[model samples]
Target chain A: MHPRRWTEFAIESLIRVLGLSSIGFVLLIFLFLLKEGLPAFLQVPPENLLGTRWYPTFDLFGTLPLILGSLLVTATAISIALPLGVATAVFVREVAPGWAREVLKPMIEVLAGIPSVVLGFFGMTVLAPLVRETLDAPTGLTAFTGGLVLAYMALPTIISVAEDALDAVPKSYRDAGLAMGATQWQTIWRVVVPAARSGILTAVMLGMGRAIGETMAVMMVTGNAARMPTTIDSLFRPVRTMTATIAAEMGEVARGSTHYHVLFGIGIILFVITFVLNLVAAGAIFKKRRRGGLR
Target chain B: MRPKIRVDHLSFYYGDKQALFDISMEIRERQITALIGPSGCGKSTFLRCLNRMNDTIPGTRLEGRVLLDGQDVYAPGTDVVDLRRRVGMVFQRPNPFPQSIFDNVAFGPRVLGLCRGRDELEEVVERSLRDVRLWDEVKDNLKQDALSLSLGQQQRLCIARVIAVQPEVILMDEPCSALDPIVTLGIEELMKRLREQYTIVIVTHNMQQAARVSDWTGFFWLGRLVEMGPTGDVFTRPQQKLTEDYITGRAG
Candidate 1:
């Protein structure tokens, strides 16, 4: 081969290796988790593994409360985030003046740069006390507190992604709407939003994932209670998530102990949930693009 | 001929940059008036001014008066949304919304609340589609996506979309520039058919297209109206040296 051709081939091969190594690392991690986690499932019978109570010290290892806790927090965070984030995105991309947009875009990026630990500290110090005093609850630390903090955390992701989607809609669509005598708001709602539907869905899914996998902030504010929520007003009640369980208990447990293996098992479950969320998002995007291309 | 729309000493500016100098013209009712010029000579700008489409752009200003039926369209508190409904526009490129064919045509009427019932809306949609001569081909596939149509069909659909609102006048900005020669001819035929009911003003870079379809023609050069008259008189009878030179292919 010519010298330039040989150089190109070598560079291409190196790039491919670098690109594939991350996927390889993920597979290795999954295999290792399975090795550690599957043993705990064998030691703890199926009934105990799937039980509602989760007293790990007394040999009860049901994770239903933790799973439900994560679901409730994530769903509440998304409900709060989706409308606020999408509306802010529309304001930034479509309604704001040039200077306001310039200022807001970077300000939102700065919000993303805030550390999770600092956010956890803020939630513990600021939001918890406010929640307790305002609602006149026994304690400030509750699922609602965790959810509010998580919603704030997820806003940056949703706003930026949804703004990009809104921006991607063609200029002609707006003009067509306006020339048809539609008001500016009507045009934005009827034309621009629908055109960017797939992208907005992606934003919501990503925001949900961020809220679901969050550990430190949720743990700091949720009071780490490991019991089933008995009341309809359980959002104001203390709860603990699977992620928090792993983070709080993993370091002190003896190596190769059932507790250690159980932490790994929780890790596997978290990984599987995130994986399924991503797969569902990818499938929806794929279907949308295929239908879009068919025309 | 009685003038349907009149422009008196109009000028336009986009952020301190003058795009149109003093211009005046009369557009007759149920007649086609063609504005012909080279690229960036302000023919399209003048066309957009007719319906205040330029108001959408930031930092743009209009001077002088534009009267529709002797009522100043640019007067204070003149309703822009209502003005657009009366004076509809078709863009250079075919821009159909990503929606069903039936929905695309029905969008204007539905949004403006023009029809009282579903049957009335369906009739308006069918009539508009038939007016554009597209109903025969697309009648069975009304539920299909509008983007699934050919480019020619999309342009016709856009025209039908405009027609559904029942505007008194239509502004077309180089409406056929994106289509092929055969499709352009078909659009020209449609334009002639549409002229029987609606007053039409078209801006085109193609002088041949202007001469072929227009009853009255105006030549614009460097934001200024050089000459305008009956198409035959402007093309055959030599008047202004610049106008004659432009028609003879000596100047633009």
Candidate 2:
């Protein structure tokens, strides 16, 4: 074989290996998680594992409160972020003048690049006290405070993705709407936004994925109480998340103990949730492409 | 017949470059007026000028007057939305909102608040679809996504969407350019039928289409009107040398 052919073969093999290695790594992580975490599910009684308490020293290990805490904080974050992000995206994409759009887009991208730890620090210092005073809650660090921080962290993702979706709508749709006597607002709401619905929904799902997987900001502000958030008022009360529990206890946990395995169990659960969210987001994007291609 | 729209020394500029030179013409009420020209000869730009659609583009400037029903549409404080409602437009390609067929047609009436209630809105949608002769074909599938329709049907739906607002004039900019010959014939036939109620101004690259459908035809060359007259005379006995050359395939 020629030397050129040998070099080509080497490059192709190297590329294939690099591509396959990511899948290999993901599978290895899943297998490792299952091997360590599966024992907790089997050894611990189902009632104990699924109970309300998460007292590790006393071997309680119920993940119900942690799971609920994560859901409450993430749901609050999304509820706050979705509307604000989508509105900002519309303003930037459809309403802003060219120079303003050029300036605003880069600023939003810069916002997304801010470290999550810094946001967490800000939440710990500024947002928690504000929430505590505003709501007159007993403590500042609560699910609501955590949600506010997460919402800010997730805003840039939602805005940029939704803006791209709105931008992808064909220019002809706007012309048609305007030609029919619709005002700019009417055209955007009735035609352009509706046309980009699936893409916008995908953006929301991806933002939710980012918010749910986030650890640092949530852990800092959510006053790790490990209590069930059963009442509506629990939104303003201290709660611990699955992620915070794993992060906080992993350092002192005895190796291969059931408590350590339970933490791994929480990791598996988080991975599954974000994986499903990304799948749904992908599905929405696929649907948008199919509809877009039809014309 | 009185002119529904009158253009007096109209000129348009996009930023530093002028697009349309001083061009003047009359669009008679309930008549089909076609502008035939080569690509980039300013026919579409002139058509957009009638309804002030050019205002949507950034850094574009228009001088001279476009009067609709003897009212200057470009005058200060002229309600652009109202002017566009009076004069609707169809584009080169069919552009339906990514929605159901019913919603696509009803969009205009809903936005303009022309209908009193759901029943009236439904009546308007049905009437508009019938006007475009698309009711029978799409009535069974009004709930289906508009994108699911064939290109010809989508174009017809776009026409339905425009007429649902009940405009006094319809401006078509190469409305059939994206269509097949058969589909183009269908649209042309619709334009003729539409002329009974609304004044129509069409810009077409196909001289044969202008000859077939328009009562009054204007020939544009290089941003200027070379000739304007009855379609028969313009096609058969064009007075200007440029018009004659263009009609005889001698020069663009």
Candidate 3:
């Protein structure tokens, strides 16, 4: 073989190894999580592991409240975010004039730059007090506060992604709709939005993932109350998410104690949930792009 | 034949760049008026101006008048939606909505509320498809995606979509440019049939096509209409040196 061929082969192999090593590291982390967290499932009884209460000090690690807390916060954030995000996207991409698009895009992107901790701090000081005063709740630090902050945090992702989706829809589609006597708004809703449906769905899923996986902001505002969310009114009440539970208690627990294992178990659960969500989003995006290619 | 549309001293501009020079023409009702020109000579621009499609582009301006049935279409209260419904357009490329075949044809009628209900809408779709000579092939697969059809079929679907609105005037901008020669002939045949009901304005780079399908032909050269006459006279007689040179393959 030529000497140049040998050099090329070596460089290609080196790059291939670099790419494969990242996957190897991910597998190693999953293995380590399983080793540390799987022990808690064996140590604690099944009922306690799946119970409603989460008093770790009382030897109770029922994750139901924590799971519900996360779900309620994430769901609330999504409900608040989806419509606003998609609307903002449409406004920015389709309705806004050129100068407005230039100003609004950067401003929305700037929201993504604010630190999560700063958002949490803002939630604690500004939003929590406002919520307490306005709704006359006992405390301002509640799941609703967390959700509001998370919704703000997730807006940039949803808006930018949905904007990109709308932008990707061919100009010809708009022309066809317009030439067919449809009004601009009607054309955008009936034709352009449907054409970009898959991309918009991907945007919503990604926004949901961002809301669900967020920890610091949620931990700061949710009041860290590990209680069962029994009623619709509990959305404004204090609650603790699985991520918050792990973040707040991980440092204090003994290294080899069952408490430490339980925190790791929560981490594993978070990992699995996010992993599944990301996978589903990826599959949906791939399918949509493939269908778009047929056009 | 009666004059269906009249353009007087029309000039178009995209921002500061002028696209169409001052031009005047009369499109006859139930007749095919073909505008033949080289690429970027403003034939399509002039076609779009007929129905105000250029309004969608920001910073574009038009001077002078385009009258449809003696009504100034560019008047302040002209109601553009109604103007578009009356003067529907077909593009150079087949741009079928990514929807079912039936939905694609029914889009215009449904949006305009021209049909009263589902069966009426179905009737319009079938009639429009039949007019385009595509109903026999597409009727069985009306629920399938429009993008699933061949390019030739998609163009026919687009024509059907435009016809479904029952427009008085049809503007086709190089409508056969994307199809094979055989499919092009089929579209030409369909255009001839359609002209009996709707006044047709077509922009084509193919000069032979202008001679073949059009009753009247306007030769455009660099944003200006150089000559206008019956297609036979334009093809056989030497009027302007430029028009004669173009028809003889000596000039663009």
Candidate 4:
């Protein structure tokens, strides 16, 4: 082969290897997690494992509370983030003037780049006390506080993706709407938004994925109580997420103990939830593409 | 008969660049007027000015008067939404919203609040679809996605969308440029039928199309109106050297 041809062959092979290795790494991680976590499911009694208590020192390993905790916090975060994020995206993409859009786009990106730990710190110092006083809750750190922090964390991802979706709508659609005597607001609401619906749904799913997987801010503001949240008022009470439980106890527990394995089990569960979320998001985008390539 | 639309000394500018110079013409009521010229000759720009569609673009400025029913459309305090409803438009490409055919045709009525209820809206949608001769092919699938239709059907749906608003004047900016020859002829036939009720203005690069369909033909060159007369006179009798050369394939 010519020297240039040989170089090209080497680069192509290198890229292919690098691409395949990431998938290989993911499979290896899943296998390792199963090896470490599967024993907890098998060795522990089914009743005990599915119970609400999670006192590892007492040999009780109920994960219902942690699972429900994660659900409540993530649901709250998404409920708060979805409307605000989508509205901000609409303002930036459709309504904002040129200079304001230029300024706001980078500002949103910067919001995303702010360290999650720093946001956790801010939540710990400022938001918790505010929530405690406003609601007269037993503690400042609660599921609601954690949800507010995570909502902020998820905002940038939602806004950017939704903005891209709205931007992808063809300009000709706008022309058709305007020429039909629809007002500007009417056109956006009736025509442009409905066309971009799937893409926007994908954005919400991805943002939910981000919020559910987030650990640091959630750990800081949730007060780590590990109790089932059954009542509506539980939103204002302390809770421990699966992620926070895994992060907080992993260092002190013995390496081969059931507690350690249960923590890995929690990791497995978190992985599955986020994986499903991403799959749904990807499915939405794929459906959009198959329906005439996003118009 | 009095003209349906009259353009008086119109000039247009996009940012710092002028796109159309002082151009004037009359669009007769219930007749077809075609503007023909090479690309970028301001024919489409002139068409857009009829309904103030150019206002959507930033830094686009228009000077002069466009009168619809003896009222200046560009006059301050004029309701632009109502003006556009009075003078509907079709674009160069078939652009249907990613929605159902029923919803696409019903969009104008829904937004303008022209229909009192769903039944009335359905009636308007059916009437508009029948006007564009698209009802039989799509009536069974009015709930289907508009983008799923063939190119010709989509174009007709776009026309139905415009007609649902019940505009008196329809401005078509090269409406047949994107279709096959047979589809083009079909659309031309539709235009001819549409002329009995609506004043139609079309912009086309095909000089033969202008000769065949237009009652009045206006030739634009370098942002200026080169000639304006009856289509028969403009195509057959040589008055301006530019119009003659353009029609005869000598100069565009």
Best by DockQ: 4
lDDT of 3 by residue, A168-222 (tens): 8999999999998899988999899888887888888889898988999999999
Candidate 4, which CAPRI tier? Answer: medium
Model 4 per-residue lDDT tens digits across residues B39-59: 999999999999999998989
* Candidate 2 chain B weakest lDDT stretch, 10 residues: B140-149
> Which segments of model 1 are wrong by more than 4 Å?
A1-20, A229-231, A293-295
Q: Model 1: number of clashes?
A: 0
Return whichever of 2 and 4 wins on DockQ. 4
DockQ of each: 0.60, 0.76, 0.66, 0.78
Local distance difference test, per candidate? 0.91, 0.92, 0.92, 0.93
Off by over 4 Å in 4: A1-17
lDDT of 2 by residue, B1-252 (tens): 898989999999999999999999998999999999899999999999998988999999988999888999999999999999999999999998889999999999999999999999999999999999999998999998898899999999999999999999999999999999999999999999999999999999998999999999999999999899999999899899999999999998
Evaluate model 1: give its TM-score: 0.94
Ranking by DockQ: 4, 2, 3, 1
Task: Decide which is better by TM-score, 3 or 4.
Answer: 4
Q: Note the residue pairs that clash in candidate 1.
A: none
Q: Which predicted model would earn the best TM-score?
A: 2
Worst 10 residues of 1 chain A by lDDT: A286-295
The TM-score each candidate achieves on chain A is 0.94, 0.96, 0.93, 0.95
Candidate 4 lDDT score at position B188: 94
Judge candidate 4 against the unseen true structure and give its global Cα lDDT, from 0 to 1: 0.93
